[model samples]
Target: MRAENTQPVDRTMDIETLMRALLRDVLGLSQDRVDAFDLDTPLFGALPELDSMAVAGLLTEMEDRFAILIEDDDIDGETFETFGTLLAFAEAKAGN
Candidate 1:
């Protein structure tokens, strides 16, 4: 009998994939555009699709998807600055 391989799964991929889906659905972005995003990619003012109107929807979507409550005071410009930052914030909020 061989020993079983045991390793903890990485949750980063799940968060990133979920975020891409949210971005695509909420902001109506193309799969190519969402796929092209990296950790350093700028959001907020940089993305024309992510405007004030879309921000609320995005936040709501995130809250619903992650089952996390995000207070008004919890978000700021920096929170939406990059894909990685948003993922990190969500991970923290989710206690993952």
Candidate 2:
């Protein structure tokens, strides 16, 4: 019998959902607030809750939940600029 792989697959939708939940949990955002987020939704400067310290916590949660490593050099203003960009960065790191 062949053994099946049990590793988690990083689907686009899954990543999106996870990202939304992460934002809510880490930043103490309301569900409605996060649900309203679309690809073009601005994140960093637009959201007062996502300041520098919150960003650190958010990144740590992202690493834990996504099982990925985020190096200091891997981030820039552009990565957290929008929901799409953040999702793209997560997808790339997750090998989706």
Please identify model 2 stretches exceeding 4 Å from their true place. Answer: 1-10
Best-fitting candidate, scored by TM-score? 2
Instruction: Compose the digit string of candidate 2's lDDT tens values, residues 1-96.
Output: 999988657489899999999999999999999999999999999999999999999899999999999999999879999999999999999988
Give the TM-scores of the predictions, in the order they appear: 0.88, 0.89
Model 2 scores a TM of 0.89
lDDT (CA) per prediction = 0.90, 0.94
Specify the highest-lDDT model's number.
Answer: 2
Residue 26 in candidate 2, Cα distance off native in Å: 0.5
Question: Where does candidate 1 clash, by residue pair?
Answer: none
